[model samples]
Target: MAAGLLLLVCAGAVLYSAQAQDPYDGLPDDYKKGVDLAMEKLTLDPGVRHHFRFLKTLDKSDIESGFGVKYIYHHFYLKPTRCAKGSTVSNAQTCPFRNDRPLIDCAVCYKTAADQIESFPKPYVHCIQKPRLTEDTRTTRTEHCKKMNYNSGAPTLLAVSMPKN
Candidate 1:
């Protein structure tokens, strides 16, 4: 058995298989299996898509299996929706946030790092991220400001009355 293993190793073929997923393409079979199992167990949301990359291993080779150990970063990107005017602040003159151009693509997807994950990362917002100096849309957080009562009493049909015996 040892002689056969030696022959296999001499062929320069690591523990990778042809049928492994694209993210685990170069990873060893055992590591791919583990990652696959782990990913299957993830509580992924409905719009989440499978996105993974092979990371470096703590050990270059598994001590038990003599195969290359692999690390992976796997997470799904949240699909961004079109910007809408949701802010209800009364003092704001113009709408906050980038309502001009929507995010065409995820910036993280084009980055060079293979093992980086962009799970639930906030997209570049114009008002928050690249706000103009003159735009007064950003809310100034105030600790001492009087709370504006939004609940100005809901509309009612009948007046309040005392309980009758």
Candidate 2:
């Protein structure tokens, strides 16, 4: 009787924890599962506050095991907001951040209940951080920030494959 009670209590605690982390009920089950899995798997340094914004669906596939969808999203590395020295106000425009310049493409896939996992090929062009302006290097290329000729458009699907389980 004691063992049975303990088991029941453990199961209830697990259920409660699961319910606490469940995403909005209105969201499709696949998306919720994918977000949860991604959140659980992806981790950065404790100091960096990162966010994942779903940009678009790259591709989708129906297989024998389950459905799989490839998604590209912005993984924003956020800096905590703070007022500038000697300034008493804080707003979006006044405050500066490292994320101002441009964004790049990164891809991830929904977790499927299958032996194989499908994902997009590795991106060729990796994102680079804007060069910081020091006293010496300020007069060089950093001056007059010229915009690159590329568009802020989503990447085309060049290749997709399923990794062996």
Clashing residue pairs in candidate 2 (N, C-alpha, C atoms within 3 angstroms)? none
Error of 1 at 49 (Å): 7.5
Q: Count the backbone clashes (under 3 Å) in each candidate.
A: 0, 0
The count of backbone overlaps in candidate 1 is 0
Candidate 1 Cα misplacement greater than 4 A, ranges:
1-23, 43-61, 65-165
TM-scores of the models, in the order given: 0.21, 0.26
Candidate 2, position 140, lDDT: 31
**For model 1, what is the C-alpha lDDT against the true structure?**
0.28
Candidate 2 C-alpha lDDT tens digits along 40-127: 3332324324333223333322223213323222122213233332233223224443444332222223223343333322211122
Cα displacement (angstroms), candidate 1, residue 42, comes to 1.7
Query: Candidate 2 overall Cα lDDT vs. reference?
Result: 0.33
Q: lDDT winner among the candidates? A: 2
Task: Report how far off residue 140 is in candidate 1 (Å).
Answer: 41
